[model samples]
Target chain A: MRLITTYLIGLVFGVGISISGMANPAKVLNFFDVAGIWDPSLGFVMGGALIVTFIGYRYVLKRPTPMLSQTFHLPGRRDLDLPLIGGSAVFGIGWGIAGFCPGGALPALGTGSVDVWIFVAALLAGIVIANIIQAAMARTTQATA
Target chain B: MIETVFTPFQSLFGGALIGLAAVLLMATVGRVMGAAGILSGLLQPQDFQDWSWRAAALVGMISGPAALMLVTGEFPAVQVPVSTTMLVIGGVIVGIGVKFGAGCTSGHGVCGMARLSPRSIAATTTFMLTTGLTVYVIRHILGT
Candidate 1:
C-alpha cells in the first residue's frame, strides 16, 4: 500500500514536471549554459515549483494530523552545514556540465534522447558511489543536526 | 508573455503540483513518492504482493509526457543515442541507488527537503554533489 502510494505520488510529480517543463523548456535549457546560450529559464522552473510547494506545505501542515496519517513527517534540523553546501556544489557542477537535473532528466529521457541516457548512466553511477560512501561514513560521521 | 518562451515555468509549476500531489499522497493516499525507488520496486517485483499503485505510478511517469504532447504539440527533440546495454546498466545502477539511498531526487530533493527532512537533505545533497562532480570529471576535466 505504502509502496503503491509512493509510486502514484512520483507519477503525479512526474506529470506535473512535464507540464511545467513542456510549457517552458527554454528556461531549463538556460540553466546549463551559464556562459554559452545563457538561458536562465530554470529559475522560472524553480519559481513555479516553489509556488506549488508552498501551498502544498501549508495544506499538509494545516492538518492536526495528515489526512493519510496522524501527522506530517517534517524534518527536524534547520541549520545548513558543510554537507549541505558541498552537496549543493556537487549538484550545481553536474547541472552545469550535463544540463540535466534529475527532475528534468526523466522527462528528457521519455523523449528517448541519447544525451539523457548517458547522463542517466553517469547519474546512476554517482548514486551508487554516494551510497557506498554514505555507508562507510556512517561509521564515523554520524550526521549531526 | 514574451518571456514564456524561455521562463521554464513548467519545471517549477510541475514541482509545485507534485508537491501538492506528494502531500496529498502521503496524507491521504499514504505513499512516500520516490521515483527511482518505485521504478526499481516494479522491475524487481517483491514476493510480498503490493503493486497496484507502483504499476500505476510507473505508467503515469511514462505517459505524462505523451499526454502533454497531445495537448501542447511539443515533444522532446531527443538527440544522442545510447545502446540498449548502456540503458539497462544505467537502470540497474539507479535501482541499486534507490535501495540504498532511501529515496530518489524527487522524493528527497523536492518532497523531503521541502518538508525540512534532515535525512532527505543529506540524501539529496549526496546525489547532487556526486552527479555534479562526475559530470565535471567526465565531460570537462577527463573529456569523456
Candidate 2:
C-alpha cells in the first residue's frame, strides 16, 4: 500500500513536470534568460504549484500522523548556514549552464538522450563526493570536540 | 536556439498536478518529495522499507514521459543547449548544491516554501538570484 502510493505520487509529479514543459532544458534556461526572449511559463508553473502546495500542506500537517509513516520527515533546521547559501548559489550557476534541476532532469531521463545520461552520471558522482565531504566534516567536528 | 513559448495554461495545470503529487506523498509517506533527496536516499537507504518507496518513485518518474505521450500522442520535447562537458559540470554542481543545500526546487522551492520555512525561503532566494545572474553573464556578457 505504501509502495503503491509512493509510485503514484511520483507518476503524478512526473506527469506534472512533463505537462509543464519543464522536461525541456531550453525552456528552463529561457525562463532564466530575462533579457532574452524570456518565458514566464516557469514562473507560472512555480506559482501554481506554490498555491496548491501551500494549501495542501496546511491540511496534511493537521493530521497527527501520516497514513504510512510514524512521523513527518520535514526539515527541522531553522538556522541559515553557509552550506545552504553557498550550495544554492553554486547550484544556480550549474542550473543556468545546463537548465536541469534534479526535479526536471529526472523525468527528462526518460527521453533516452545521451546528454541526459551523461548529466545524471555526473550528478550521481557529485552526490557521492558531497557525502564524502560531509562525512569528513563530521569526523573533524567530532575530533575537535 | 529553440523558440521560447509561453504556456500559462499548461504550466498552471501541470504545476497543480505536481502540487497534488506532493500532497499525496505527504499524506501517505509523511515525507517531503524532493527529487534530489529522494535520489540520494535511494542511494543510501536505512532499510528495505526506506529503499522500496524511493525506488518506486524514481521508476514512476522515469515513466512520466510515457504517460504524457499517451495523452499528447507524442513524447514531450527536450533540447540540451550546452555541450557535454557543460552538462557534466552543471550536473555535478547541481548535485553537490542540492545535497549541501538540503533540497532542490521541489524540496525547497515547493514544499519548504509551502511550509513557510525560513531556511527554504532563504535557499530559494539565493539560488534564484545566482541562476539569473549566471544566465545573464553567460548569454549577455560571454555571448554564449
Please, what are the lDDT tens digits per residue for candidate 2 over residues B28-85?
A: 9999989988999988999999999999999888889889999888878888888888
TM-score of chain B of 1: 0.78
- Across A35-126, the per-residue lDDT of candidate 2 in tens digits comes to 99798899988998999999999999999999999999888989998999999888888888888999998987887878888888999998
On a 0 to 1 DockQ scale, where is model 2?
Answer: 0.86
Best by DockQ: 2
Give the clashing pairs for model 2.
none
Q: Candidate 2 chain B: minimum summed lDDT over ten consecutive residues — where? A: B1-10
- Interface RMSD, in order shown: 5.9, 0.8
Query: Which candidate comes out best when scored by TM-score?
Result: 2
Q: What is the TM-score of chain B in candidate 2?
A: 0.97
DockQ of candidate 1?
0.27
